[model samples]
Target chain A: MNTNTQTTRLYHSTLSPFCRKVRLVLAEKKIEVELVEEKYWENPPDLKRRNPAGKLPVLRHRGHMLAESQAIVEYLDEVVADPALMPRQPLDRHEVRRLCAWFDDKFNSEVTQPIMNERVWKKITRSGYPDSRAVKDGLRAIKEHIDYLTTLLEARRWLAGNAISLADFTAAAHFSCLDYISDVDWDRSEAVRDWYATIKSRPAFRSVLADQVPGIHPAPHYAELDFG
Target chain B: MNTNTQTTRLYHSTLSPFCRKVRLVLAEKKIEVELVEEKYWENPPDLKRRNPAGKLPVLRHRGHMLAESQAIVEYLDEVVADPALMPRQPLDRHEVRRLCAWFDDKFNSEVTQPIMNERVWKKITRSGYPDSRAVKDGLRAIKEHIDYLTTLLEARRWLAGNAISLADFTAAAHFSCLDYISDVDWDRSEAVRDWYATIKSRPAFRSVLADQVPGIHPAPHYAELDFG
Candidate 1:
């Protein structure tokens, strides 16, 4: 057990998109953090003590245990000024947040959650066999999401706007998770594929790219910067 | 159809806590909005056009259709400035957002969504009869939440801290929905009940108090300021 209470530590699961978002932001902001993989599925007793909500991606920073990925990332952006993830104008910020919610809530529910539950979690937790129907549904849903992203990319340089904001990282986080399991059809949309390639090459994404979840090997092109 | 595009409009469902949270913030800032009730259950085709995510509480303001309740409220707070709902310090803001997410995500999942799905939506959509077991589960889950709120109230004047912020509104939004159906056991925690009373009596709460959903009458004491 590390006795240093001052050290910024993140309690997270490697494959969880929420945790990965926080990790990416922390890296993007050049903040040093010790990542502690938390098996939230087991209902770790201390998880409740650390966070009343008892959710993952809890950050122990500056004596505060921060929970909720969006809140934590926003806080980091606020505290650390350089390379800001949020935009200046209220409307721009709203666009960023709206997209963040879109990915976190809608995309997660529609694409990530069902597929991850079927493929990754069921295998890791030994819960059950993957439901092909659920996986197929998630795969089908991702096509629409990819099309939407392509449309957005055509209009703006990034998902929310011209600049690469938290929305990009958020969207990338979900895509990366699915990509790890070889679920994403990178060839589906040229623009989305290009966007992912651009974001994937960022230094901030390095830590995430190097992640190794036991028993689940990364897809051949998962960490390839030029893949697809 | 209202031709006044300049007039602010809110596409919402009366019972949705997400929409109600945005409404509370708008009312607190005294932003007059034309309420356009959207029967999202029927999958209004334009809902997708208005908001790609196709969720309700979509606010059409300043010619932009803003989606996501938290994002819209935060944007309102930023643009309005007066009657600020967010705290000053980054830490304080984070606390407010954390609690807001706690209610919106955690509380909604455990308490609001299940109960409303079984008790309210089923009846409204004529989908099926209420499932007593699901309703009971939500009712049971809410007790733990009330207890947690009681603990938080013991330490601070509001849900986040000494000052009233979006956290309070977010929490009150969910509670109000449950309270409408006479689901909340206000007797569980005096502290929580008192908190609700304080928030309920605010002028901003008027429109929400007056809400009347077709085929589903509110509980007799739902609108009473001194209900508990």
Candidate 2:
């Protein structure tokens, strides 16, 4: 095993929501990390050797190689407990995890994955032209997600509960990716817009807001703290 | 609103891997639960209202409605400490969670979901006939996964580590579903076959081994404890 436990490094892609989620959590906990952009789609041989799953957002921290965004974030929360991203109660923790899944699995399949695959990835990878139908469907599905977030925000201060948890950062991670492309129509729900604005202005969100993907230019308001 | 905190009820589908994972965990913890089969594809109106994500398995435990399989299982482990399913250390816990994601996300997408959607779901829902191409691809994918499991089992007692964890149950849940259909090539790797046999004989696995999805007959050797 490598004995260089002092340095922390993250293998990530700029616009990938999963990567951004890890970056956000790491930043929130005030951990310094060296970011290395990985072109995972090219199927880097070393990636598979290092991580069996061969997925991104792989963190090399304290001599351990960690993969999976949720697992990494939860691990970070456990090891570095200063600003707890998870709640104490099991039931409350369940809520935080449920919403994380909501954004990562459900919302991702419905919105982010489809839209990004068409709008951003295709252009970056030179795979093909955008599929209008897929983009339209993703755009259509996002409205439902935004409305659902409105309902949650109406009842509580944050996405999962009153205290900001990994759920909020998870949701923001996906939204920021879309927002970078100007896909989110912030006008649909003022509550969600305000929530995004508040989260956007945070110190933790600075690195993410400043992201500049080479081929894809971020929207004019992408980095604005007070876009609303 | 639910005064029935005394009764633990799970809304699930018999053949779903996610539902089986929850069932295995609940049984391991000895939590008595009433399983209600949900035909989620029919777009059960109440599923949406009860759980915002509208997915299974949704567990009503201690008066709180819980959704997301990983969230529910982790919650169960947290609330009921007997026969601990997660390791205490942060790194070990990360390994468990990462392996759980391996089976649930990667294995499900590559092997279980495609095979089940083609072979089992299409037959149950009467949507269409089995697509041999999809089934073939899933079958091809399972070999690589089984090989990876073999590599892990060679060094450790269980999938994630020595102690049987949520990783084992999570893996068994998916494998059991596919095994029900006689899809697994038992001869592929002796290590994996032995590992499955060991996990299969556990008392907690009885409920899952006894599951009978309507209109789908299980493979002849599915529930046999000493199949090897």
Compose the digit string of candidate 1's lDDT tens values, residues A31-100.
9999999899999999989988989989999888999999999999999988989999999999999999
Off by over 4 Å in 2: A1-5, B1-5
What are the chain B TM-scores of all models?
Answer: 0.98, 0.97
The window of 10 residues in a row where model 2 chain A has the poorest summed lDDT is A1-10
Clash pairs of candidate 1?
none
Off by over 4 Å in 1: none
- The interface root-mean-square deviation of each model, in the order shown, is 0.4, 0.4
lDDT of 1 by residue, B55-93 (tens): 998999989999999999999999998988889999999
